[model samples]
Target: MSQSKPEERLALELSCAICLQLYRDPVALPCGHNYCLGCIQNAASAEDPKSPKRCPECREEYGSLETLPKNFKLSSIVDGFLVATTGGGLRGGPTVPCDQCLDNPLAAVKFCTRCEMSLCPSHLKKHEERHRSLHVLVELPAERDGKRCPVHLKVTEYLCVQERLFLCSDCLMEGSHQHHEVQTFEVAKEEMKRVLEELGKSVSDKLQITEALVKSASEGPTDKAEDKLVARANILQNVQYVFSRFSTEITVSIAV
Candidate 1:
């Protein structure tokens, strides 16, 4: 649970705001929001090129697609993240075998949370037949063994911020988290989305400043070593600010 939680947050960070998938050739907009290159390009193509190009996430306008920077560092990190999460070769995590299988266990297609068992299609149909109204069957591997409150054994729909854990409805009424600050998962996710938007704006501002400085330097004669050093220092400072803010926001987001 400890490891999976962080991986989930990392997955969120790597996902494109448009496609909602791991980035394929990620690029950064002038607004500092990241998206898959093809996704953003297709969006730009769908609109009039002469008109101001606005980011899908932040709606910040930029001039042209030609000026958008490919996020090579983020792309590299995506590669590593995929490898680490998927165990280097496989595109997905290991399949959960059907708990009902007696021999030669088949891969599970769904998980019955109420029964607390993974099921193949045959077993799933039987499960649906007998307990259609009662059972909560979720797609296998996606929800990852189903998110249930350990104490109440109910589907966890709320997050207890004080305890840094998920809570079911009963938890809010009678569990240890009864008096703590809590929010629905949907609300928490929305809050994180706003945090991400603010982080994007902060990055955009810092990068714009750095870009302006670089453009100014490029326009003039930069033959002196001291001038070059100063330019490099300013650029580094801006970059540091961007990443520091990003880290802080992401940490807060994961905690939520």
Candidate 2:
């Protein structure tokens, strides 16, 4: 049998790499490989901290972690294309094929600043082993308490109910939040809803008052018009009475 062309072989390989899989949030690595972001992170964390990560297939080095961009346009295109081609197997959802190659959608294993694409876990691990030491691996929500953490640089999720501020878990446990009531996200959401409702009512009342004032202002010209009509009618009546009396005097004088 004749051997498959290199391009065709590459396409086939790419298809196998992402077979039956759609990328969620896609990321890219510096080596131009893609992977699922979550899968990559877990893999990177699983290995011994001392050893470097290696590529799953070629054992090539891959770089550190990064966030994937939501490719909404590509997502829509892939979703439509899959629906048309797969008949019913690929359900319509928010996912897209890789823009560079159609064989697989970009996997969001980790983000790559250099490649600017989402990578699969395999690609992400390789990147971490190879380039993580040189470049920083930035996590999402990149700040906390106006300070940056060495690892994960993400803003901490802890919130203080008494202070009405977001804090790191460490800060919450510190002396600053001692004896203060701490609440979870659900409680905060409920309080926010209540405040929004009160604000909505106040806005509605103000709108109603504004509408009444506008109506009254619109009627001011009409009131002035009515007053002018009444005054003119009264003046006309007085003039008519004077004319009648003058005619009567003329008639009486002629008769005499």
Top candidate (TM-score):
1
Please give the range of 10 consecutive residues that has the lowest summed lDDT in model 2: 140-149
Candidate 1 residue pairs in clash (backbone atoms < 3 Å): none
RMSD vs true structure, all candidates: 26.5, 24.5
Q: List model 2 lDDT by residue over 36-91, tens digit each.
A: 55555666787776776654446566655554344455445444444543332124
**What residue runs in model 1 are displaced by over 4 Å at the alpha carbon?**
1-145, 218-224, 251-255
Specify the highest-lDDT model's number: 1
lDDT of 2 at 62: 65
Residue 94 of model 1 has an lDDT of 48
lDDT of 2: 0.47
